[model samples]
Target chain A: MTEDKFKHEEDLFCSGHRACPGCGAALTSKLVTEATGPQTILSMPTGCMEVTTTPYPESAWGISWIHNIFENSAAVAGGIETAYRSFDKRNKEGYMNHEDVNFVVLAGDGATFDIGIRSLSGMMERGHDVLYICYDNEAYMNTGIQRSSSTPIGAATTTSPAGKESFGEDVHKKDMPSIAAAHGLEYVATASVAYPEDFKKKVEKALEIEGPKYIQIFAPCPRGWRHESKNSIEIARLVVETGLYPIFEMENGKITNVKKLKDRKPVEEYLKVQGRFKHLFEKEGGEEVLEELQKIADSNAEKIGIDKE
Target chain B: MTEDPYEDLKISKGAVVKPRTTLVNKTGSWRSEKPIIDHEKCIACGNCEKFCPDMAVKETEEGKFEIDLEYCKGCGICAEECPVKAIIMEEEEK
Candidate 1:
């Protein structure tokens, strides 16, 4: 239960910030920073999180945070980690200690999957001691809900409207976890805000690892998804329960763990909740798109071997 | 309020002199509604306390939940997710 996960006393993410009501990105950031503790430095790129949390004189983050351009968060984190290592070596007898400082990178899907992939790839290939977290809200939510590479198929957005000619986004969501795994990082995992325990454990585990670690969390956007604010966690849970978003972990290019669904629900149960997919149910020939999406889920289940149990 | 918002930029290249300074900014005016808890019907489930995105709900010394109106954005999430009907959202007073 979520109550069991809230035993910690210090909340690194305090109140009185400007996040929208029931934002999954805000919730995920809270859980992540709480698990990371006080001795951490975060590198955030230009995105919704950076804009909403840090508006001039106010900042929601309690840790040492630096905001960079949209595509260089990974690169900035690498520089920070390198500089900290050098300082730690030079100031062995100094008053300050910088040995156990954690370096993290937080960016949205638009930054990670589309514009910032090159820098991210370079960082992972070099094996920097940085934990990169991409809070996937499925599209460019900060910029008026525009379509991004991470946007799923048959989902409506400002750029990919479901009009007479187009059926929303034509392609599927990019496979980012697998792309990260291909870089042969020490740790890579997928998590959801609905499962706080699992998400916290992954954050803690990533902190323990030595080299580059990547965790992409499935964060739902209420304003962009056109769902009620209170249903954020519920929608996140349904996405996983329907096998649409597989929760898994990898170590050194091999799959180590997968969270299987005991009672898998139909994909329709997950799609019908969000207004982004509302057109699919209303328009003709939309059943084919749903069928295609279901097949993709089934294929994901088969590849992960999650349905065997 | 401080006259110069960029006063900190003169300290160093990228140093954050004052941490957690956001406490000074009062964001309560952003709310359109307010959540009021009925202490008589409260059960201290901690769900409201745990799930508040802003951390506006706190557990009192007597094990009761209290919403900090100064920070609560009237998301109504606490009332919507409350196990019991102890919490209700009323229109914010002008």
Candidate 2:
């Protein structure tokens, strides 16, 4: 019960940001920044985190932060890191010299898996010394809960509503860790907000590596997922336990570790709590979708080795 | 010292020059219900502090914990995750 790994002394991510009451992204930001330290330079894109934390006159970030266009957080970080690398460290007037700071991108899945994939790919391929953290809340949550490429199969959203004629999002969640690992980076990992100790350790590990690294964090949205606000952390844990979100790390294109579910729960324990997956229990063919979703989880457990036994 | 944290940087107009100035927002106003902790039953396991989304649960000088109403958004996460069932959410009186 005493999870001390999540403990940190830094106040880099100050409170009073306008995130929702139980925002997983908000908590994720605090945890990531706690792990990265005060010397970290952050690049964010347009997303719930960017909007909520900057309410015009006030900002929650204590460290240096930059948020430009939607698709180029990684691009900007690459440029900033390149600038930092060439600067004279002895020159006290230099904004920030190399070896003094870690360049990082804190982006949403919409900006990451969809709109910004090209720039992200370019940054990783160019081998920029940076870390990119994607707060994947499953869908384009801030913009009225639109269906994103990262949305899970059978989950209903604004664009992929469940009706008599159609089921929810048909496509599976884009295998983004694999995509990031494909760039030949030293580290690519998946994390959840529920297990913040694991998430924090992953951030620290990614920063220690030389080249570009990607850590996609599962950030559950209370409004988007249609669950009780207080259940945010619990739901995040449930998502992992049900095998819907595999928590693992890849180093040099090989699986290193996986967080196995303490209690392997069925999809219903996870799905029934959220309204987005409500169709899976109500509709006629929804049972089959649940089974199919379970199959995906089983395949993930097999492929990722989340369950060794 | 009342000195601005970002004063040295020449950012443009409307730039946030003060670090953590958002503490003035008092997000506790957003709460429709507030958590009331019964210290008699409190185990002080710090689960509330660990899981607080708003960083509102603070360890008191007595080693027990108390909620900082200034930042608590009344998400009830503390009550939900409380190991001792010491926290009870009470409806706010508007």
Candidate 3:
């Protein structure tokens, strides 16, 4: 994927409101809009990206956008696509038929995984021509860094605080790609802000597919995860290498391709860097948790078909 | 479905919440009903309780869970993550 293909003259997620410095969600939105172009209509849900970009009256989004409650973004996007198509079908001269106009839904992990899964599943099952992009910063950063269904096990969130007898967010993140693919949707993929070119390519691929498309983006939340803003890309890269978040895609219900990986690191490398996981190492029995995390990573590498080097 | 070998699988304190279908929770008056659950099945899994953006689900006694209908936006995580499928969401016309 070339950089030019993902570059745009107009910024969809502008440089104003309040996203933490070097916010990965911000970067993902920018790249998505650039790839999808300005004519896109964004169906946003309540989350960090939504809160940060649209602070009441002011908004950083440059495209036609609508902020719906957290769970119904997919439903709203589906309806918008239906409306757009119906309008275009009635009028021959209507500008709505332009290929640049993408009916896209931008949602967070909480919205996508736990809350919106039903509608999201419904949208895919219905085979609507919409793109659902989940910018996963792990925890629900908008609501004070609480745990979300997407919060990986052993990671600390407000709701899943590290305590003597507790393991943080015990369940694994719902595998969105697999779930969406199971619906026999045209496309489902994973991307990260660290790889803008790859991320843009995945968006483009989703557009080419006739039915619904889902892209779960691994966005870094520094404040919530207690990391420096500058290390967003670095940490994102580590996430992939560690197998915590593998970059891959599924077409229909079959695995088509997996991204290249060379230097595989222990999950502890990724965990040790974040303060959220600090307790897992600093606490008396934290090392055991780190070992458990390693097992999780190794298993994901195997399941996703990421060849060990 | 096969178990996700990656999960830590910590069972929270209390009776395991039984998973229910959408049909079970249907109340005629519900504009939307958020499932308040039994924490025993919860394992403090943080599945349903975690993603609730409205802060609806609260851990009461050691292993108990309750849903605050007042703040709930009607996003159904409690129903979705009930490992036992204990909770179900019902939307009734208001």
Structural similarity to truth (TM-score) of each candidate: 0.90, 0.91, 0.73
- For candidate 2, give the docking quality class from DockQ: acceptable
How close is chain B to the truth by TM-score, in each candidate? Answer: 0.81, 0.81, 0.50
Best by lDDT: 2
Provide all candidates' interface root-mean-square deviations. Answer: 4.1, 4.2, 19.5
For model 3, the superposed segments whose C-alpha errors exceed 4 Å read A1-9, A92-95, A98-100, B1-94
Worst 10 residues of 2 chain A by lDDT: A1-10
Check candidate 2 and list the clashing pairs. none
For each candidate, what is the lDDT? 0.85, 0.87, 0.73
Per-residue lDDT tens digits for candidate 3, residues A99-190, read 54788999999999988998999988897889999999987888899888888888888899888887677777767778888888777899
Candidate 2 lDDT tens digits, A1-309: 233222212368876788899999998988887899989889999999999887776778888888878998999999999888767544647477677799999999999999999999999999999999999998998899999999998989999998996679998889999999989989999999888889999999888889899999998899999999999989988889988899999999999999976567887899999999998898999998999989988888888877745
Of candidates 3 and 1, the better by lDDT: 1
Q: Model 1 chain A — which ten-residue stretch has the worst lDDT?
A: A1-10
Q: Which order, best to worst by TM-score?
A: 2, 1, 3
TM-score of chain A of each: 0.95, 0.94, 0.93
